[model samples]
Target chain A: MNVMIEATKLTKVYQMGDEQVHALRGVSFAVQKKDFIAIMGPSGSGKSTMLHIIGCLDRPTAGELFIEGLNVQEAGGNKLAEIRNQKIGFVFQNFNLMAKATAVENVELPLIYAGIRKRERRQRALAALERVGLSDRIKHRPPELSGGQRQRVAIARAMVTEPAFILADEPTGALDTTTSGQILDLFAELNDEGNTVILITHDPTVAQRTHRIIELLDGRITRDSSRNGVGA
Target chain B: MNILETMRSALWSLQSNKLRSFLSMLGIIIGVAAVVGIVSVGLGAQSSVLDMVSALGSNLIMISPASTVARGGSVSGDAVDLFTVDLANHMQETVHNMSLVVPQVQGSGLLIYEGANLRATLVGTTPSYPEVTNYHVQTGRFLHELDVENATPVVILGSRIAENLFGQANPIGRELTYVVGDRRHSLTIIGVMESKGQVLMGNYDSQVYVPISYAMERILRTQTVSTLMAQAISAEAASTAVGDAEFLLYSRLGTTDGFNVTSQDEMLETMGDVAFTLQLMLAAIGGISLVVGGIGVMNIMLVSVSERTREIGTRKALGAKRRDLLMQFIVESLALSTSGGAIGMILGVLIAKAVSDFGGWATSIEGPALAIAFTFSALVGLVAGVYPAMQAAKLDPVLALSHE
Candidate 1:
């Protein structure tokens, strides 16, 4: 297995007036290529902070993180932005798709940041949307779509650039049971297609669907288990 | 980001709020219009004054007699001796820079020719009067030195007076009778003068001219000359001519200085100075209007920033630089002001032309003023855009991204 993400002694502390809130505390983790991993935690744990660090959306206060053999903290603003644009994709809990743009335009944003021409970006975005079973909603805005369909559009946006890792921070947190089930199936399908998927959630049932689960409590990982070939 | 893309985005954004954009540009429009209109008025007045000054002969000087201290009795040689025929003769002979001199006395009477009658001013002048002033005969012949030598019953009618008495027919060789101070005398019209338009005082072509000796003997019945007219060799030598004339008069008349001599250049300089000060005052007034317009732009841009906060957040998340955001707002402001300036310039020019055509005044639009107005409006836009751009640039993506 190729190690896609490697972090050592990752710690983050935020100041709240005279008090300090420790978001992460010297947590170490490694993720391999094509791995479907779930970070399970109770409320106020460091799961989201760890996920943010892995996605390079933030810098660690007292640790070093390497994504695909590049030191993220040493990277400059343009370099960090390039890594975020070309190597990582994000899916927020609330389906953070730009509501003003149509479904295809929302998917085409990463490609635009990559400086792709308009025609090619549209073609590639349409194909990505089709792969996510959203071909008929190409011209519809998010306000005109259902919750599951909007989540599919967000997934399409995350996969449009063919990034190495997809960071799903509570991807199904806002969906109902049926919609969450469909989204979990979509994640399984995406993971089977040789892409690394990191799902951050607090639900045990959601964690059980992945190949491996890491449970976090009080800003530390207490249990790590692999359910290899069990769901298969 | 490229300038073209930013400009396109700004234009598209502004198009989304047509009424707001128009309202923001209104300040710049009024400011530019005020600047252009005021400058046009000032320029028209300056040019009109220049025309009037040039119409008078450049080298001419006028001298008026002194006022007597006592009205009951006149002193021997000190009183009533400032202007005289002897003084005029002495100045002409002794003043080296002088070209010609004429003594004039004036009165008003009715002019009668055939059956037509018109009220007119009667002026008594020497044969050299036309040469001393700018007036000259345009038709027939002027009253020559021989005419004045013989006290000939000859007169030169102004163009307007000729037109009033002779209706299109030549007034030359016609007889015009003037009743001056109870004496009625018939004089032959020898010449018609060219038209000299009006000035600050009055029209120069409304008076009637006759030989000085004839007028003094036949009309006023006084030997004291009313005024002395002096002409210099050139415009630059007017002061020298005046000094020489004064010296000669003082030496011949044996009197101290009690007379006043005025030159066309002196009067023009004073008028130009006053005009320049007025232009400065008007420009300051226009600048105040522009400042008020700038405040309007600033206020509108602040509103735009507040309204577009979410949009700015999205752009920042998309990796737009601070300069990119600044450029968009700045371009919006410049577009507003430049468009307003263009409309204002056109309106100002049209207004100037309309005034000139309707009021029969010489009104012109100055090129430098138009350029200045445009530049000033652009500056105002830039100043107005600064606060808004700073506010837009400082928006934090974390908070803005989650903004509802």
Candidate 2:
């Protein structure tokens, strides 16, 4: 019950011609409440695969994944959708905001799925964008804004739902150093507000900001350690 | 989600690709329009026919002896037995709402007057002929009851015939000799009838009229009338007159199955049925055009679905249900068709009116025809939209999301 994400012997396989490629080789892990964990690994190391499975966007080939004490492996698409709607917020590396929609509209995407009324969704989306300090740029479309601004809009979109877990797959991967620092400070502020944050990054500097880091090499965790005090 | 929200979203999405959406709707528009226009034209034709039939006098009925035309020869029934003086008298007395009855005999003859001669139809009829039919005297006067009783050597010339023979001179009180079969009879023209105009049959003012007794005794040489003409009290009494006349004639003749009794009402009803059939045929023709239009819509919508893969993915990710997406597309198609149908209906009515006004025909634009055409067009849209909407709604969200 204390574990937020409990993966037991989770494995994912792919068919490559006549051979089976193992993405996750019976990997198991856990994270407690308010834990800010970073997942780090080289390319094709199954870090992104693990994040996809944990985000309920894909199912593991074999094993059980429990989040908030509920089994997710057998849940149907609708149930997974509901879980994704209410419990998880994802930020992709490429900042996948709808091209036609403005910043606030993108942030209101999850609330729209939650069946919130238009006026209220707009208000909440605006508040979340203000928290990321993009309040004046609500009407800006993804193309109209800089790469960093688009990423902040995506972060606001993730945070607007006020979900239990924030899943950032390299939130600052496309941002400059200055914009990366701003986004990292926003994520730290959200973690300070007692929201569980899970960031996956290849940059060690990005991983250093989290309370704990889990480093994987070739689909196996080579290091799992806390830094300063807090899950540290 | 509420319908309004769904519609708003649909409208927004449609607004994003105005040209594509409009093109997709083009099919429905053309289809609905074709249906409305064609049916209106058909209904107008039907109305005109009915009006012409009504103007011919509602109490009138045409009866001809049933003849069998064979490859070798033709067989004619005994005309005397079918239309007799006794039968005419009985029809006048027994048929309720009966006004008058006139026995008629007809043959082709030559009328000679003032050294001018023309081939014309010779009609031997009672003085009541003018009353039973709608023809009236335009010159001197019609043959009176005295003329028929006395079997006077007198005649009534139709306006056209009188003009040809007399050349604007007073045809009444003039002498004309009619040659029929092998004999010629000198007759005085006592009256000239006004022209009633020709309809489907032919010109009315091209015939000459004389007493039935004179035609039978002097020319035909047989005690048999070729036809009988009966007048009803009013147009509304036509059906009653037909029923009563049929019953009276059947009882008098002691038979019913071998004869066909018809009134102007029956003729008009037959014409109405024909007009309705024509209207249906026209509607079907229009429907073919609509179906082609629907195919156009389907083709365009397929393109739209393909082009909007990312949009569909976005909507699916936004939690749009399959039914919602289906409804959006269907509604869009319907709006297009209905709008087009309305415009087509106006165009059809205008076209029908123009024809009616120009040709002086008794034409009409039927309301029910317009309604049916519009509804049918909408149905076309619904049918056309189904496949494309399904294709759009069934797109996998992951695949759509990954699409550019």
Model 2: residues with Cα > 4 Å off, grouped in runs: A1-4, A14-21, A31-38, A93-98, A101-104, A137-146, A168-222, A225-232, B71-100, B103-143, B146-227, B231-261, B318-371, B392-394
Q: Is the docking of candidate 2 incorrect, acceptable, medium or high quality?
A: incorrect
Tens-digit lDDT track of model 1 for B1-404: 56765676667667767898888777777778878877887889887897787677758777766664644575643535556677777777877787877788887899888788888887888878877777898898777878767778898998899888887998888888998657799999999999987754456678888887788787777777888888888878899987876666567556655666777787788788888899879878878888898888889888888877766654554445567778889888777777777887887777767778887767769899999999999898888988898888777644555567
DockQ of each: 0.21, 0.22
Q: DockQ for the candidate 2 complex?
A: 0.22
lDDT of 1 at B226: 80
TM-score of chain A of 1: 0.95
Candidate 1 versus the native: TM-score?
0.76
Score candidate 1 by lDDT: 0.80
RMSD of 1: 5.5
- Clash-forming residue pairs, model 1: none
Top-scoring candidate (lDDT): 1
